[model samples]
Target: MFTKRAFLTLLAICIGGGTAYAQSDPLPSWNDGAVKKSITEFVAKVTTQGGPDYVPPAERIAVFDNDGTLWCEQPIYFEAAFALDRVKAMAAQHLEWKQQQPFKAFLAGDKKALAEQGEKGLLTLVAAAHSGMTTDEFAKSVADWLATAKHPRFNRPYNDLIYQPMVELLAYLRANGFKTFIVSGGGVEFMRVWAEKAYGIPPEQVVGSSGVTQFRLDAAGKPSLLKTAKVQFIDDGPGKPAGINMIIGRRPILAFGNSDGDHQMLQWTMAGSGARFAGIVHHTDAAREYAYDRPSKIGQLDKAWEEAKAKGWTVVDMKQDWKKVFAFEP
Candidate 1:
């Protein structure tokens, strides 16, 4: 009973609406540029059925570096700050710390002395602070710290400082059938405490450095895992690839990171067969975020930066490529 002209108009409207919906932007936080185009195009090619570059859903593995890549790690790594705080909290019980070199310098706010202590000193602090507790207790402690600790410059909870564009990218990849995992140099226990809530990546999907732990049975017949001071693994640089191979058991098709620590991971991903994507989130926005490469002590991006450029990997200029850095930005 419908008029032919009216039927044609309804059909046109439906078609147009569907087209608009299909064209909606998945990475709204990213600016319209070559970088964005490359990302979208890569995704399209890899997802196209029967295409040469098409990757099966089960094989679409993506890995990301957590600190500085997904969130900020400046002034000092957040875990370092937590370790320092833990040292202060435990100082009263350990009188020997008053005479210890790094502890004494740290407690007295001697920056020069603390710097002299270097990596060894830092490890000592971490061991002192992170060990001697049950895994559940350690997790609760990390969660409690995250609930209260704020970044000095941003004055916001550390978890709240995650990159908006990267978060969107994660979701877009997941929507396209990519399984995301976080591969970081930070402590496995520390990252697992808040990563799921912050990045939509669950704890089991996180691969990171770890300290030794022992299973214990309490007098009440309660079985628990106790964290020990012994270092087990360091998931950085070459260790990144080793961790991926050991844990994931599958080479990632896509890998993203911010510094030299991720160099091996990027290299490993690119070495895989078929379509591969490697990206570096360059911290060029000093105003909205911290910026440093090579010279900086924390999150140095020297060798990896050069490699990314030479290999034609997407190196995102955070200041230019992202319209919004953080969700809190106006």
Candidate 2:
């Protein structure tokens, strides 16, 4: 009974403007261009009553990828940068890692050495430093590190590298009754710990990769999940749809990402019968954020480029679309 026509009608019905009133500019800092237009149009459609493209408030599920979509991901992912730092800091305690391939590469102060290990090596490094601690412990460590670690280029806290446009988009969507979620390849616990503080998205709204975790009753008689080497979920590529299916249950009307890992997420969002939207945040502003796509090893923007065009997904070229990179980057 759920036909495309019914979905499209619902989409049209849910695109009406809500009762939100802005004292100043609704999106004051947003650049006056396609990013703003697309966002405004989407909001209007979803919030305007009697509009042909209106979508229901409850059905306005908009999911966004964390790294390059919401913030900078190069020269490498922020989490990867954290992982590298962790390897170096903990290297003193784990002397065995000093002789290891990726860890040795990490310890020797050569990023390329770990590159030689490729994906498997990177995963090994992530698991080694990221696991072995309770989820809260890992979160606290991340919070502690982010409090001091500065970007190599911008000399600002890693958390400060988030994109302003995306931030506005998140606020705008939520203001219009769109329930936003972060569906990323980054560790679920890793992002869940801080996303709410920074992006206003709660831990329950975040879905991402996670290593296996064991349930244990602690000294205080509390149950918690302990991180382990065993991979619980990858949460990338096709796994994105799987995660959304499992966690959210309902398909999203909109999805945003920046690389091949997000292709399946875009595909899944577009496949649903409705006024669905998919956008790829192309990293084309080296000055503002970063500009390496096909050649970049981490969060590479290759196939997603093709998929964006072929599927008619909105491709956000940072160089042209965004006037600002971060909230405080003035």
Candidate 3:
């Protein structure tokens, strides 16, 4: 059902034996297989002009869970490590924290003590370190730490361990007119500092858990939100979809994640009326990255992996599916 002009345009490119128009094919580094095929097909249908399956650019929204999907989330969550480091480094300012239960545990580098504190202790650490600073200061701290922090196993900067195939998929989707948004459990401010350079996703497009802040003029009298030790937002589980709806407005045509935290995000994306796609990056490559799934304390898979097959969702197995892990040679 092509109009005359549209038909002639594509036809001419085929005819003159000219270098053919790119078909938004195989996402460069992605292996030529089912995963790549599904991703390409989904993107092509949505972005092609005048096609019956075409969706307008405004509605061409894609949501991604940042940690395991875009990079590595093994051994522990990246932001959790950030919290632990912040507590130890800033302990000088608050000697009181050194005596506190979880803070003492964190300060001592006692993994067993930390485990004893569990979720409540983790929350205590997060609230303490993440709050009490301005947004700009928080972002700078994250950038500074990320620059120096090495993965315990890899001994490379955490940011450098980003998955190669996923990176290609992001760029490929963008070439097909999709706007990508990060819906992660990590702090929004933490990811915003490096997301643009790391993922080609702008700061405004990233969404994540956040703490409360208040307007306070610094010594320079510039307007800014100085952080407060209160939970303003927690963009995980059901909160992810709600955050996306509130912030991005458009429902996603595609969604990718690696944990149960993103279950709701996939739900929101697939709930879109037509041609929606959702996938999960299951960490099954211990050699290349880390072998982990449902049992892993940090990025637990459980329900996401179970529901993926039931829902016909593509599961990217790190060992079998991805031809390579980090784009840079490990």
Candidate 4:
């Protein structure tokens, strides 16, 4: 019933609206807020050619923490859950574990007992579960676990719990010529197994704690690297900056994390010359996600929370800043 001019005018309006929508939101999962604004503005300033804060594409390194930042780390860490499952699976082989401190606690679902064992106990569990296997075998095990293991809360595959906004942010940064890397406290091998597929970050760009690996040839003349119980490096707290230096060889201009463990990395990133960005993903949504900070034993955010306020770093309130928590969420 419309005239040709009227139809053409409507088409033009529709096209213009689509174009604006496409150009406006690189991070669609993020809500319109100060946190989102800061991130976009920083990226824009650094990427604009010949701008005062312009940085070369080659130097646009962005580092992100894995647990509690890019994904959920609640009830228990995903890696720890994997290790505990491994313990249970291997319990038949090691009968003595029934009487062991951490093993017994893990087997009994005794959170109190397991916590008492502390970092030393956690390391013991990691060594027992992660070691004595070939690198390929370990990778396969992790892959298989990720494929089958469902989150206790969401009942979805663990990898599916990754934050949708963070995924968008990663893509946005990469699209703008930034190289993204995961700087985490989790085991390097464990994360490398699935990180590339989940985060679009290759294995080489992942910096994390590592265990010793020894190369050997089998009787059939097959060469393989065997994981050992000895810890080579721990990539948490102060170790984050050191790992970045040793592995990445350059300080990241942008860094994001969710815990006090990432405090040093944020510090190191902001300490760099020129325009830089540091942000913390504060877990403030108990309904959609976990809400814990100072009191929580896992992924504690006390010191970093205080420092973020003091230094004017962007602290993203998950409940407020994210339009969607996971891709699966309606």
> Highest lDDT among the candidates is held by which one?
4
Clashing pairs in 4: none
Quote each prediction's TM-score: 0.92, 0.87, 0.89, 0.91
Taking the tens digit of each residue's C-alpha lDDT, what string does model 4 give over 1-330?
799998888687676544445447878899998999999999999999989999998899999999999999998999999997887888999999999988999888899999899999987997899999999999998998998999999898999999999998998899899999999999999999988888999999999999999999999999999999998999999999999999999889999999999999999999999999999999999999899999999999999889999989999999999999999989
Q: Where does candidate 2 stray beyond 4 Å?
A: 1-24, 110-116, 218-223
Ordering by lDDT? 4, 1, 3, 2
lDDT of 2 at 141: 86
Q: Tens digit of lDDT per residue, candidate 2, span 189-272?
A: 889777998898999999999888888998999988788889989899999999999999989999999999899999889898
lDDT for position 60 in model 4: 96
Q: Give one clash count per candidate, in the order shown.
A: 0, 20, 0, 0
Per-candidate local distance difference test? 0.92, 0.84, 0.85, 0.93
Query: Taking the tens digit of each residue's C-alpha lDDT, what string does model 1 give over 1-330?
Result: 899998887787676544434338888899999999989999999999999999999999999998899998998889988888888888999999989988999888999999999989888988999999999999988888888989999999988899999998998899899999999999989999988888899999999999999999999999999999999999999999999999999999999999999999999999999999999999889999977888988999999999888989999999999999999999
User: What tens digits encode model 3's per-residue C-alpha lDDT throughout 183-248?
Assistant: 998888888988899899999999998888899887898899888888888999999999998999
Ten contiguous residues minimizing lDDT sum, candidate 1:
14-23
True-structure lDDT of candidate 4: 0.93
